[model samples]
Target: MGPAPTVHAESVDFVMLYIVAISVVLLIGITVTMIYFVFKYNRKKGHEPVDIHGNVLLEVVWIVIPTLLVLSMFYFGYTSFRELRDKPDNPFIVKVTARMWQFTFEYANGKKTDTLYVPLNAPVDLEMKSVDVNHCLYIPAFRIKEDIIYGQTNHLYFNAKQTGDYDIACAEYCGLNHSAMYTKVKVLLDNDFTKWYGGNWQPVKNGSASN
Candidate 1:
């Protein structure tokens, strides 16, 4: 079908759009203000540089406006980040281990694969650890990325809404073949995943065919 959907899709979109909107507004405002000041106080126009003390009202306006804007941005970003950090209850948990240049996923049923297989629309918790150096599991489609440490357990969650194969890669630079330290996350339909989980395992071809 189409691309696999992640639970963080909307949140990511919101955060990105919010940041972009603010950036665009600020960019335009600052650019226009600079241009206006350039022409309004041009040296060629015989205007001398005025070294007057700054007006308290202008200073307060600038400070308060930017402070409010920054606070609002922080609020939105923190809210979105909090949603990503809050783990779901009783999710389909998978333990992920990163070693050298390979990735492994182990399920509760003892089923393991180099590729992560998750059920569509179901919350999946990835409990991750690194065997050697530090690594980060980055799934761009799910907007889920977390650092994996040798002595610590790092986790992230996602819920795929569609069946498809998404790319997974290590965001951290481990060593040689760090670029090759990549894999796929195959999102399957609920029924298909159930069958596979129950040991009636079959390959999913073209993301639609289970054979």
Candidate 2:
């Protein structure tokens, strides 16, 4: 009922809502219809089954309705996907290198960190590449997940609206320590991020590396 933490989260939420709503409606409708049919046509009632051989109108209605529904779902899904795929025009870029079990983020100022740091209410673009095998960068709070392929460049953009730490995980299993491929994204206010990025502000430790 409320907006998600990130800007792109709203769009993802909308798509998910649409899908869940449609699924619930269909489930209820089918359940109710089955119950009613069972009771109405019970053998105890001495009722005879009526044949509905080829009702053209019914056939057309079912076919057309489902076709339209599938098309609509596909359209909305594709639209939301495109919104994530297209990179921001001028986003704060960070280079991410993913290896067997660790993530190395290189900021514009040449500062590297094991964890991610971003500014609130600002668009940040992550350019990711895998050093050896396949990996995935997943931010659950932001609803952004993209694969990091070896020798191929992949990227995704997100705008953090809240100032807090969010979990980041490698969605793909790369090696033996794939589960250890975890980190946190620290979001700070505009001024604090500026200070930290400029190497002036010291961030409080939250069990992960900040520098």
Candidate 3:
């Protein structure tokens, strides 16, 4: 048997690192400030709390700093999302249909199925919509997730750089079987994918087939 695909695992790791770093810095800063204030103004330590409340300059500084920080975060997040969703010059277009407890993927050649398959190192544009209730097309490995709203189409794009099996789950609560609404994405090397699609080769259960 061939080896399972690696999917977009690296992207997930990068995103996780970014989140962790941001969280750690914020936590440490808050913790240090809290501890410093507690020790500096302790009653038993021959210190008294200064009750100089409502300093305009301090209030303005706190408000402006937090506002700027939040806006910066928002800008970065929006740019990241824009880059992820924008269609590349020539992407492999795929149609995705989300249902109550399953997802159906359709290739450009009119083939349709539950599983998602794509060529590695290629950009893929997912034109997705919901068939029944609202659902989300979530590929954690790619750091991409978009809602598949009923009666409306949503799109997402990603370049799969690795070959592996990746999980696809609904990020929104659609129905009873929301937990079971999942699928797998298989990223195949370019040449191997061509051979597989052309009937010249088949993917083995546990082997690496390079492009």
Candidate 4:
């Protein structure tokens, strides 16, 4: 309804809105056309059913237009996915471990917490995995989700442009207590985050500030 909450969220929103808009336009157009034809060709008016040959132009137009629309949607979606896979040179990495009904966020400094704490406007990369069964980490505000499977790792990253708390839920339906599998992302200011994260982590040689 409003602007994107994170840097990559806008890209996802763009692709989503494009598909939705196209679907709505086509839906209305087809519905209107179908109704008009139904009433115009009513049998009650004694309209003769003519065996007419199909028009090549009309058939080609329908086929080509739908094909182009599908290709365009795939293009937008693929580009957005590519952007998500590109990691920064000096990203702040967080290990996200999911189990039966809980999530744990481990920072570089070995500090673990249930609630994710990230600095505002800073890029955060998540390395996610599950201990037992499969799970999925979903953050609607950030428009990011990744599967957490045992013996495999998944990744998702986002830059929090806004400062506040956002809900994080498990989209995958696990065993009992799945409804309670939720957490919050607390976007803190730099000073506050530094205090929570302790001192400086491993230094970076990229001429930029380190987490």
Candidate 5:
């Protein structure tokens, strides 16, 4: 887990851990039970075998327990997925367009930039699309990825509590230069974001920051 963001880190990671833990427990339990049954029910040299068809309680317990476990896992998985789609209050919407090896982020004021810049502690809603082939918007640090499909608009939701520059890359194989499609998302303090959001600000050069 590298530089985990708030919302996705909590919800997504919890669901993953929950499912994994349950799987590990089930694996051990089932293996042990199988071994024990194999030893106990082994055939004796010359004894007649008893015909034990089935036990209703044992069968019901097995079916009910697995069904309940599966349902619970599905419940948590659905809730975690819903958390990503839940729009926050007082959101800052950015329109993102992806093409063959490039990403463009447009703010509400028509200010466009290659790098995504947002205020710390503020919610950001991304409206994404692709101009050419399909692309994927991926932020590894935050563990967020969304598909950018041509002729169809996609969306990604973000809320960063900390301030820093996070790496952004195209995860989908779009074209020959797909490996070179990369950018950064800068989360600035509230005061700086306000000043830059309202002013006629210019984008800084690569390897440089306005802060």
Candidate 6:
């Protein structure tokens, strides 16, 4: 088994922290407002609930605040996505094929295998396609995931900074054995990867074997 997923970049970590901060701020604001309104307008405080139909200022405040919040979120999310999707100048390319219950990775030298082998600190571009049904290539550690349609190819790029093993799961339900369809990703040092790629490496018989 591989180690647990880890966020490998400062930028990704910052984006996650920003999202959490926004959520906390929104939650606290809503909670405080709810409590204040409830206690201030309670019946036991000699206060009768006045049905002041609606205030134009209050309506505008609510609408404008939410609109601004949503737009801000959209802008940040779009920029982050674009940054992640942008291709590097010379990224390592790998072809990933998904079938009924297994994943096969093919490197640039035409070596096919079950496990994904990548060099640490090197950006990898994965071209994914499904042979039988729809599947999703998900690598939580890298915060990258994309769907692999039967007739279409999907792509994603990421650089792995840590040299270790990670899990590759099929996010989409393809068949009865979809739950069992999974693989491993091995991130190696640059020297070790060069040695492996330079030497003749045979493909494993099935996706269950280790790299």
Q: Largest lDDT belongs to which candidate?
A: 4
Error of 3 at 70 (Å): 2.6
Q: Of the pair 3 and 6, which is ahead by lDDT?
A: 6
Q: Please list the residue runs of candidate 1 whose C-alpha ends up more than 4 Å from where it truly belongs after superposition.
A: 1-4, 199-211
Q: In model 2, what lDDT does residue 203 have? A: 27
Local lDDT at 6 for model 2? 80
lDDT of 2 by residue, 11-39 (tens): 88888899889989989999999999899
C-alpha RMSD of each candidate structure in angstroms: 5.5, 6.1, 6.2, 2.0, 6.3, 6.8
Poorly placed runs, candidate 6 (over 4 Å): 1-10, 199-211
For each candidate, give its TM-score against the true structure.
Answer: 0.88, 0.87, 0.78, 0.93, 0.78, 0.83
lDDT of 5 by residue, 20-66 (tens): 99999999999999998777777754456788999999999999999
How displaced is residue 70 in candidate 5, in Å? 1.7
How many clashing pairs does model 1 include?
0
Q: For model 1, how does the per-residue alpha-carbon lDDT over 79-138 read when each residue is reduced to its tens digit? A: 878877665546678999999899999988798899999887767789998889999999
Better of 1 and 3 by TM-score: 1
lDDT of 4 by residue, 26-96 (tens): 99999999999899998898888999889999999999999999999999999998877776777788999
Clashes of each: 0, 0, 14, 0, 0, 0
Worst 10 residues of 1 by lDDT: 202-211
Best by TM-score: 4
Q: For model 2, what is the error of residue 83's alpha carbon versus the real structure, in angstroms, after optimal superposition?
A: 2.4
Looking at model 5, residue 140 earns an lDDT score of 80
Question: Candidates ranked by TM-score, best first?
Answer: 4, 1, 2, 6, 5, 3
Residue-level lDDT for 176 in candidate 6:
94
lDDT of 6: 0.79
